[model samples]
Target: MSEVQFACSTEETHQVGKPQAPSFTGPFTTEGGLTAITLSSPSEMDQWIGEWIELAQQTEFCNAFYEPTFFQAAVKNLASQEDWQVVLIKEDAEDKLIGFFPFVRGRGPARLSELSLWKSKLSFLTSPLIRSGSEQQVFKLLLKHLRTMQPRVDLVELPMTLAEGRVHQELHRLIRDNLLTTYHYDHYSRAILTEGHDYDELLTENIGRHHFREYRRQLRRMNNLGQVEFRTNEDPEYGECWADWFLELELKSWKGEGGSALKQDPQQEEFFRELVTSRTRAGGVEMLGMFLDGEPVAMLCTLVSQKGCFEYKIAFDQEYKKYSPGMLVQLHKMQRFLESKRSPWVDSCAVPNHPMINRLWSERRSIEHMVVSLGRPWANIVLGAMPLLRSLKRTFRKPKR
Candidate 1:
């Protein structure tokens, strides 16, 4: 924990009706003779936010798959719905924005006497737009800034996705060196296109395979019960109808057996609805559906961004499981993805070790994990006890069948 200092300028009195404004003070000193400043106003933060994002995008580690705008929009959406803080870090020497960390107050009884906060939406995997300089120095500065606010935050859980990157690796190293308590959780799925040299060639290759013959045979069998057809929103006249059909099909599919995909939870539904509505306006949302007798049997919701189409979600009618409607729907979606001008790869986010994603997609990607702590002896003791605690908890649970 650090000390809190109150500083006041003549302007500060007008803003908060106080002679002084409270600011957290910490012991971590800046490198390169840089000073730390926190921006409290959103407009102030936005002033140099664009430049900060540009720096991150220009970094060698940047991936087009995670667009800056998407993250910015997501952060804004979360902040608008709740009381949260968005912090911006800049170099005092040049006043250059170096990092952005969005976080909110932690809700629950405080086990410790410290106020707690968490990264907004477990945003560890999403890098704070950092400039291309000494990453280690910048990261150290960022952690120092976080420590200053330790009185307001207890545990920092960053659910970093696709962790096999240098930035994440370095972060883990720092955390371990400092002896912080950290846990790694398996987050999402990644899949690669196994059938093509390029997008068009891959579609052609898939269609020419013996599996395509079997697909057609199954389609013929499904059609006998009614009419089996693949529908997409590429056409203007059919676009809105297809979108609605996709949503309905997703609700009725296996996902619906437990609960409707989007409608399963109100919050998830809200997130998807907002995502689809907003992204569709930008010509990003691509909805695909498999219809039987004009009723959708399976549906997939995807987003085309940069050079890839993301298979965001997919579901199929449980009754049509024997007919493999889910597989049929994916084949149709992949075919459309290959033919589109978007990009050459389709990202099948994350799936369990199921036959669909594991057996079908040959390309593989690894997600990494790291633990961070504040280099305290007590912190190390608590972290050390976690594995033993987990083992004891597991011992008490009944074995699964």
Candidate 2:
């Protein structure tokens, strides 16, 4: 860790008797010349929205979860209830904003003395927003900045990072260059629909002739009950009401029965609502629904940006589960996605080996949880023993046979 002071002007500095500044500090530049600043509150993010959105628009890796609007909604409705920090990295020469990393320091006894990228259960990807060409430099500065913070942390965990993406590739380079010790866990790939693939080819290759025929057979069965249709809604006028419709329809699914639906929690419900409204107003939301004679039986929410689109959430009316309304709606999304030239791809954001999405989309994006030592002696010791600790844990967890 480098020794860097908290440099500030006389007026900006806290006095013995006067009140302190609003937890904002630093253009803390490292010897490598990248500067970092930490924002203590989400409201402070308002000042950097322009730069933040621009960074998202130009990032080499697309993570809709970290885009400006969705990120703000997450902070306000989900993460605000906890302690967090947002670190901004910039080029020292031109003072251009290049990286955005929001994280929560571990808390409570057995705190683990670590910092984790901030994300709620509702979020999927965990890649930070970094300018397209500056990933390596930005990552170096981010780690250095983190190392200089008070009550020093031992480990840094980046959850759900897109494996082999530019950011991930850069992290590998940094690990070698910095001589950093690192560990990876929960590595798996989820379905994705890349642009330029013919929809017919993609569908046939993934679902197979037997399943493809079965899909048509199921649609025919649905048509027998009512006029079946799949509709994509993008107009802002219906954002709120349609979001409500999605929530209600989701509540009719197994998730609701198991108490895991977004509508099951007040805060999570508000988060989705705000996310829909904000993204809709920015022309960044699209809702897809499978309707039975004009009544929606399945719905999916997609959040869009210049980089790409994310399949954020989905729900289906349990009454229509046998007919596979959920799968049908996904097929519709894939077809529509291929037809549009707006974004390069749509990430399913589904869990690894997801039964439905994996069968529909053959393309996969690997995600992983990575832990790296912060170069502290204690951090090094913990990381060195991690593998053995994990082995012991698994051994103890084994069932007596």
How many steric overlaps are in each model, in order?
6, 0
* lDDT scores of the candidates, listed in order: 0.56, 0.80
lDDT of 1 by residue, 1-401 (tens): 24244442334334465333223322233556543444433334454545555555554344322344445445545444444445555565444556655444444212422212223341323444455554566666666766676344444545444464556666777776665676453444456653344634454454456766787688889989987787666654444455456566667766677664656655555555656665666566677778888887888877665545567678778778888888888877766555554565665666546477655565765554323344445544555566677789899989999
Give the RMSD in angstroms, all C-alphas superposed, for model 2: 4.8
Question: Can you tell me which runs of candidate 1 are displaced by over 4 Å?
Answer: 1-83, 90-98, 105-137, 150-154, 176-212, 220-231, 234-243, 291-295, 307-309, 338-341, 368-371, 396-401
Q: What lDDT score goes with residue 331 in model 2?
A: 80
lDDT of 2 by residue, 1-401 (tens): 45455645334454588633223354364647677877666677776676677778788877788888887888777875655667788765555578888877784113557877888878988888888889888887787777877667778888888887788889889989989988776788888888898877777787788888898899999999989888766578778888898999999999999999989999999999998988888889998899898889999899887778889888999998899888888887888888987889889888777888878878887889888887877677777787888899998996989
Work out how many backbone clashes candidate 1 has: 6
TM-score of each: 0.69, 0.90
